[model samples]
Target: MKKVSCIFIVDDDPITVFGIKKMLKSVASCDDIQIFQNGHEAHEAIKERLKEGKIIPEVVFLDINMPIMDGWEFLDELIALDIKEHITINMITSSIDPLDYKKWNGFKNRCPYTLNFKNKPIFKIEANDLGCMDIAS
Candidate 1:
């Protein structure tokens, strides 16, 4: 599998972020890892990077519920930006609501880049299964 260059974890929960980061560090060979507490911050930073012609993350782990902007809103803004790079997005949330799943499925249909829906507290196995690990290793 291709090695991921950069990754972004966009979630409000500090504990979740820490756990995900730890898991990724153990399993993946990504070069850069960025953390954002909310979608608004992530969105602004991404836009700034785009404007500056800087490297954007190849993968994004986004949570559904946040203070400034929610995951769905983030997706809307992201798609509207028309970013040229192919960034895979995984919806990582604790929401077990059927409606959330439905919405995520709908978003996946609309945006092919949205890869999978993962629950909170991502595991090493799941990360590896998602092709996030270094296959050459």
Candidate 2:
């Protein structure tokens, strides 16, 4: 397992973000952790970082349901950017709709960076299962 340099949590749910952050802190060694309320904000920030030649997040936890922009929309925007960085995206959503899964599979096919499609409320065990280790060590 490799320690992630940076991580992004793109979800409108504060509780979900908090839980994920706490779990990440406990299980993974990440240098930077960024939180965005929606996909739109995350997308914009990523573009800005790219423009400024700054390091983008290596991993992203995205939620499918959001006010401004949904996870799928975010993935579309990200693919459009064609960023060269090796980013791994995990789809974390509460949606039980089968369509969501289908869409996620389609996105995974289109975007090689996508890693896992997980249900909401991520826990420390899930993080460990994802193989998050301190690569810096």
Candidate 3:
């Protein structure tokens, strides 16, 4: 039951962010949750934190399509920064487009740290969804 110090959720949709934050509280006690409307703003915030030598989020949920900068572009910027290691990032977009899935899968293959693709309402904080992994005391 380790608490996540910070959780960064980057999506253009406000409602989606609200739902995800609400669900997260049930799993781990997050000290702070930063919600950004677009990839650019999210990326900027991350960089700012890094500059201040602050602890980054334990998890980041990114959306695919967005204004100013999309998820793909943010990934490129991230790599260009020679990001050796960072928190686990999961694509949480609702896009069912084949191309989007293909890109996501490829990235997963390249960077296994980039975890599973979870559609909306499938936040990783569910206990029942833990299935066999849920050990019985």
Give the top-scoring candidate (lDDT).
2
lDDT of candidate 3 over 2-98, digit per residue (tens): 4667778889888888878778777767778899888899888878887898876667778878999998887776655555554667777777788
lDDT of 3 at 3: 63
lDDT (0 to 1) per candidate: 0.81, 0.81, 0.72
**Model 2 steric clash pairs:** 3-135
User: Could you tell me which 10 consecutive residues in candidate 3 have the lowest summed lDDT?
Assistant: 128-137
Clashes of each: 0, 1, 0
| TM-score, structure 1 vs. true | 0.87
Q: Report how far residue 137 has shifted in candidate 1, in Å.
A: 14
* 1 against 2, candidate with superior TM-score: 2
Full-model lDDT, candidate 1: 0.81
lDDT-based ranking: 2, 1, 3
- TM-score each candidate: 0.87, 0.88, 0.82
For candidate 2, the TM-score is 0.88
Question: Considering lDDT, which of the candidate structures 1 and 2 is the better prediction for this target?
Answer: 2
CA-RMSD of model 1:
2.8
